[model samples]
Target: MLHLGLGSFHRAHQAVYLHRLIASGDERWVLAGGNLRPDMADTLTALAGQGGRYTLETVTPDGTRDYEWITSIRHVLPYEPSLAGLIDVGADPRTRIISFTVTEGGYYLDGRNRLDLSNAELASDLDGRTQQTVYGGVAAILRERMRRDAGPVSLLNCDNLRHNGERFRAGLLEFLERRDEPGLLDWVAAHTTCPNGMVDRITPRPSPDVAERVRLVTGRHDAVPVMGESFIQWVIEDDFCAGRPAWETVGVQMVASVQPYEEAKIRILNGTHSCIAWAGTLAGCHFIHEGLSVPAIRRMAMDYVTDDVIPCLHSPESPSPIDLAAYRDTVLARFGNAAIRDTNQRVAMDGYSKIPGFIAPTVRERLAAGQPIAGVARLPALFLAFLQRWHRDELPYAYQDQGMDPAAARAICASADPVAALCADPVLWHELAGDARLTAAVRGAFDEVHTTFAGALHG
Candidate 1:
């Protein structure tokens, strides 16, 4: 397998799973990992120096810490400006699976599920200016694979986006279509499969202390160490065109449909995570555990799930088999793990994407059912408050949003009626953008942010 985006999450989650499999003496599959962009250069250098070996640090909520040396990534390809290494590996017939972790916002799909050609990166890729985007790099690889008569490959999506596999395939096909690669499109359709998969593991960015802790526990001066929460889950659809590893043996759920699990995780876990980040930031909290420590911020997350998301997901007519209440509690408990020390900025950076992907669906569902959106309404309100801080340049750390247009966001924040302006954003709200109920509900919630949480804001 050739995996793209060799970040900490991959190190902690997928790589760990593969390591377990390899450790069991099933060495049929080994990952050759690299990134499309030049990121984590220092970590990559350290990992390559150690022959693709790294230590994984996992901490349970109860503060039980464990360290394990992961050697699943047998090959760490060096970053080349032309992506020669990645393309060569991906075009190889031995590489049956090509997986990636480009984050939820990286797909660059519009609300209508089409490629957003307006994005400069996508435009450049379509015009053959560059091959850095996922679509561009994958297209180049597929074209070469077709030329090489590589038997087949599976394009696995390991991200938080709903229907990730299907969506990515759509974006990739559209990208090829726009680039006028008819033969490539036909080859992709015949030779590859994009399987949707859900990945979960609260892997935080490695702080400096993480390396020190790893050295203390493992008696090795490992420089490319990664850390994550003890809790981990992966649910994938069983639709690989090419053969895949026996991931099911390692506790990976190989199901016919990943819809139920992905929906549950996206709303119950991801949505609540954003709420905690936004509300926590407003409350002057630095870390996720600190935010969960605040009763008010915690309540906001709980109520949103309890009132809006749960009903939409686990309706009386079509109930979910998973014990949602237990799942919700487990999610909150995971967030409350102080040892993880997940920062608010990391969770809070991508509200522009999270608003539509995570929060707005619940709002839309409740409003369509003639139900009150008061619970889910607070999430957008919280984001608006958070956006105001960014607009005023008051945030302590840099905010990174791949989907946000800075000028548009600034205009909305500077508008006389910021709440109304936010409610009317088509990118965030889609068809319900200008709905009066949405506007009014968000207005009430925004006012509540000032009135109910005035002390936090002022403090």
Candidate 2:
């Protein structure tokens, strides 16, 4: 197996599952992981130096912690601008599956799931100027595999994207089309499969304290130690073109279609996670636990799930009816985990993406059904306030976003009707901008936030 974007989540989630399989005497699948971006060079170096071994720290809500050595990643490839090593790994016949976790925004697709060729990095990649973007890197790898006839392969996307596999395939094929490589596109269609997947774990960045804890528990210096909540879940579409590990044996839910599980997770867990992040940041809180600890913030999140999302998702005749209330309570309990210091800044970084990806789905659904959106609109309202504060450089810590346009965002924040200006952003609100119901709901939510949350954040 070849894994890209070897970040904290990959180590804490997928690697841990594979580790379990390995411990149970299944060694057919091991991991070859590396970063596609340069920011994780330090982590790559540390993992490579340690022969792809790292300590995992799992924390319970009540502060109980456990440590384990995760050694499933047998190969740690170094990063390169050309992505030569990654391409080689992709082309290797023994590597039947190449999985990725490029976050929600890294696919470089617009809201319509079309390739955003206008992005400069993407433009360069498509023009053969670089092979850095996921599109660019994947295309290059596929070409080599086709040339060498590396046989059928599976591309598992373990991210929070809705119908991730289908969307990723669309963008990838479009990228190949732009490359004028009809042959490679056809080859991929005949030779590859992209399985939709949903992965969840509250993995925070490895703090210095985590490293120190690793040292105390284990007689080793683990610079790349990863910490997460004890709870984790992975649901994948069982459509591997080549073959896949017995992931089910290790508790992976291999389903025929992961849509039900994916939608429920995106709306309940991911959407509420964003709610906590934005609310937590606005409330001058350092961590997700602190945010969820706020009674009002926590209740708002629960209401979003119980009142808005649950109704949309729970259906009697459907194949899978969700226990959304149970999921909401479980998510709140996870967020309130003090030992897992999931940061507001980390969770809050991608509001632009989250607004559309996680929150807006519920907003759009509720508006069409003439249902109460007061609980749902809070996500975008909190985000708009968060964005305005970001415009004023008022965020407590440094942050970046794929959807940020500093000048335009600042202008909107300073407009006579900042909330309206924000609501009308074609990229974020989509067609909902003209809807009277949405506009009013969002504005009311924003005002109510100030009335209710201003003190907690300011104090």
Quantify all predictions' global Cα lDDT against the true fold.
0.91, 0.87
lDDT tens digits by residue: candidate 2, 1-459: 999899999999999999999999999999998877788898899899999999999998899999999999999999998788999998999999999897777778777779876678888989998888888888888899999999999988988889999999998999988999999999999999999998989899888999998898887888788999899999998999888999999999999888888998898889988899998888889999998988989889988888899888876655355576777788888888888888898898877778888888888888888888999988888988888788777888987787666777888888988778878887777778657788788899998898877664331
Best model per lDDT: 1
Q: Which candidate has the highest TM-score of all?
A: 1
TM, every model: 0.99, 0.97
Quote the lDDT for 153 in model 1. 94
The lowest-lDDT stretch of 10 consecutive residues in candidate 2 is: 315-324
TM-score, structure 1 vs. true = 0.99
Off by over 4 Å in 1: 456-459
